[model samples]
Target chain A: MKNTLWKALGILILVYVFAMTMLVPLGPGLLEFQDVNQVIESTREGRAVPEFQVIGFGTHWDQLPDSLQVFVQSKGQLAALEVIRVDDATHATVGLTLPYSLPAKSWNVLTNHPVDGTLLLENGLFLSDRFIDAKATWPAPSFIEHSSQLGLHFPYQPRIVETIRNLMLHVPLWFTMFLLMGIGFVASIKQLSNPRNQRDDDRAVASVQVGIWFGVLGLLTGSLWARFTWGAWWVDDPQLNGALVTVLVYSGYMVLRQAVDDERLRARLAAAYNLFAFVILVILLMVLPRFSESLHPGKGGNPGFNSYDLDSALRAVFYPAVIGWMLLGTWMYLVTLRMKRVNRQIELLP
Target chain B: MQGLAFLLGLESTAIAFAALLSVLSAISSRAGAGFGLTAVLGLPLIIPIVLISTRYGTDILNGILWIDTAHHLLFLGALTGGIGTLGFILFPYLWRD
Candidate 1:
């Protein structure tokens, strides 16, 4: 009863992860500006006003125009701008009045909609040279309060907007692969310590076999995501290369086992190789990728998704996904081990 | 010159070399050469895979275009093909013993 309950729990968590990751809408945010690089020139009539269109994603356009606020961040200070018009579901035009002596060459445009929260377009405008005394500081905009309740939603990330859902699938698969491989590593150690124990050898091989399946799934899902976001099915990324190498090395472990004919000798050789491969796996997947630059997150030069981008809402689903995948992987390994034992018994009967 | 070829075209070389080493190690184990010798011989052959992957991986991390990586991929493909042909011819001899 307990075993069935545990299996049911794993399946339920996975179903929850799948539904939530797919069903939840992306939070309201700015998609892009029609003209991100609008030039504002200095004029005799005070500040020069430049107008540009703003396109928002997942935003409700039914709100009043007065409620939509825009600001330009220049010289480390945010200056409030005037919204000239709000046109339809995704379009808006905002006017920015620049100071005569703006020290900053670039400015970021931020839109604060009353119902949609804050959306930012980084370095959205370039400021041209103007004639005014160099002020020590720029005026800061007053903090606008938003009262809209942004129900359950995934955080909006540029480039990986809709494809961000793949994170629930891809990352958890790798996590489960690592967990299963870790199990294999432990079993290999036990096998090596007690060379006579056949069960330890069975456990090691079973874990690795299932772990390889997860690794393959990870690679496939990662490739699909990369195809959508990075514009390639495969790129020369350190983390990606590392993952491929780790998988190949483990595959080599299985080949090595098949090559040896003697039962006792095969067990010993496989255990030793398993230990070595595990060390290499750690170095390839974890240590080396950190030192080098990679397009993948949590690696060199790239901020992890969990840093600021993975909001609490994502964490609610992501953590459960990892746990669910791990449980499922473990169950698969157990089934494989049982099958191996049964096969061995059948061979003995002859 | 051979070392440079192996270094620059590591992934393909490693794939071929790993297959060769696994076969050799398996044969050697049967002949009582033991796991130590198999590992010692295999380790050096696989190093190029690690070296080249990390070296080119840096460029990839900096977002190199696919066009720029064409040469690397080409060289890797050539090496793999050559080694695979060699392995096919030599495997029968290796397998008999």
Candidate 2:
């Protein structure tokens, strides 16, 4: 009864993850300000500044965002811009006039919408150094600023875009793999310490075989995520190589078990190999990737998605996904262990 | 000068691979599967040495001072020690039959 209860809970949480991962819309983001002037060199003679197009992701430009506020911010001051037209949900025509006695030559763009909240693009605008007309009237910043939005949203990442939702699906697979392998490692140590305990040997082999299944699933999901985001099915990367190597080593453990006919001899040999293979696992998965440059987040000085301001939104689904996947993996290992036990019992009977 | 620094990494790699190979060879001999068994078992254990040495060798080639690579050198030393220690402990059981 308890077994089925936990399995049901795992399924429930996974359902929640799937629903949230797909349904939650991404927060608005500034992609590029198209048709931007080469430089905002405002002249005293000609038209002040030309109109430019702004591109955004997940923006509601079509619904008449009367609260659409675009500004150039520098040195704790802002110059509000005029929105000339709205092309669609993703694009808007905006106009900005240079404010004299400006603090910096390059400034970022900040957009505030009633529905989409605030979006920013760093170094969105650049200006020449010659303009220093203190007497000139700067565009007064009179727009009423809106606070953070009320709706739930995942962060907008340029690399992964909408596919960032894969985080819930892809990462938990590897976490489950690690947990299963740890089980296998512990079972192997037990078999080595007491050779007469045949159950431990069966447990070790069963858990490891299940671990390999999880690891391969992790690789396939990871590869799909990579293809969608990194623009390649495979790339020369430290973390990827490490994961591949770890899986291959465990597969070799299986090969060794097959080649040896004697049960006692095979158990001892396979247990020994497990000890060595676990070291490789720690080295490749835990140690080496951190010391070198890796495209994977949280390694080699790259800040992970955890560092994002909107991380709480992701954490809401991500934590459950991890727990759910781990529960499911434990359930699989138990089933495999029982199958191994049945096989052993049948061998003895015959 | 770079060539000399790389030799140390290569040397550590050789010692690490040899330790892993000794155990693998015994298993292969017992299985009587020869190179097929050896290659599958050996590649995973040996690749870490290749991974670390390539990183170290590239550093030397790029003019990163030998002192700066203390971490990788330590990693290599630790890997060799680990494989050797495991071989020393497990070889007895493997050789008994």
Candidate 3:
């Protein structure tokens, strides 16, 4: 009864993770540039106001005109601009009057829509020193601000959008794999300490067998995610390579077991090899990857999932997925142990 | 101080891999003339680690991100750790017969 319940829980949690990962929508945010008018050098020097058009995605365009304000984000200050026209939903033209003391270089154009919040178009306008007088004192622009919306949606990361959902899948599989392997490591220690006990040897082999399955799943899912986000099925990433090496080393452990003929000798040699494999797994998966720059987050200088990636909404599903997968792996290990015991019983009957 | 550390790391990693290869060869030979076979098998496997460590060591000497080098140092720890644990656990088995 307990076994069936644990298995059911694993399946249920996976289904929930898959559904939530696919269903949640990305928050309303700036998508891309629609049309931007070039700021001419002579016109920039003159006193006339400069106008530009921008298109936005996931924005509440209907609350425009009165509630809309635009700003040129330059030199750490937000310079407010006048909204010349609202062309349509998702389109607007805003005008900015340059101060005599404006800083040279391109400034980001930010729109403050009451409903959509602040949307930014990076490097929207360029002010060359060739046009503006160098000695002119730049006018400080007033800050244009808007209240952020309250809703449940995925955070807008620059590169990863829908693929961010893979976090609940890819990350948790590796975590579960580690948990299973940790069990194997402990079992191997017990087998070595008391070489006479056959159960400890069985437990070590069973844990490893299940752990390898999880490791393979981790590699396959990671490869799929990498193909979409990193633009290749495989990149020369340290983390990915380390994971590959770990799988290979563990696979070698299975090969070693097959070559030995004597039962007790096979068990002892396998236990020792399993311990070696576990240590190498730690080195390859956890230690080696950290030193090299990798596309995978939480490695090198990149912020880990804990920082901004695993937001509250993600954490809600992510934690459960890990626990579910771990329980499932443990259950699989127990089944393998039972099979080994049954096989031994049959051999004794003969 | 950093250069000395890099040199120490490089030498230690090379020594460790060599030692691990020798141990692996010794174990494989129990089956047959397995030293040659094990060397042939293991050299290819360990080359990637050696190549990466060399490249990373150069990066360290050239004043790349110190944090990055520190992470690579962990890789060495892992290599030594696996080799060390395997040696301790498996040596008795090899000596039993």
Count of steric clashes across candidates, in order: 0, 0, 4
Per-residue C-alpha lDDT of model 3 across residues A152-261, encoded as one tens digit per residue: 67665555766778888788889988998899899888887788868888888898899899999999999998898789999988788878878877777777677666
User: So what's the TM-score on candidate 2?
Assistant: 0.88
Q: Which candidate number has the best lDDT? A: 2
RMSD of 1: 8.2
DockQ of 3: 0.41
Off by over 4 Å in 2: A36-46, A74-78, A99-106, A126-150, A307-310, B1-4, B30-32, B67-71
Error of 3 at A94 (Å): 3.5
Per-residue lDDT over A211-328 for candidate 1, one digit per residue giving the tens place of the 0 to 100 score:
9999999999999999998999999886887687778778877877776677776776777667656766776677656665688888776888855888888999999999999989
DockQ: which is higher, 2 or 3? 2
Question: What TM-score does chain B alone reach in each candidate, compared with the true chain B?
Answer: 0.63, 0.86, 0.75
Candidate 1 at B46: error in angstroms? 1.5
Distance (Å) between predicted and true CA of A328, model 3?
A: 2.3
Highest DockQ: which candidate? 2
TM-score of 3: 0.83
| Cand. 1 TM to true fold | 0.79
DockQ of candidate 1 against the true complex: 0.06
Clashing pairs in 1: none
lDDT per residue, candidate 2, B1-97, as tens digits? 5567788888988888888999999878777778788888998878878878888888887989988875787788888888899889878877664
Please compute DockQ, using alpha carbons, for every candidate against the native two-chain complex: 0.06, 0.58, 0.41
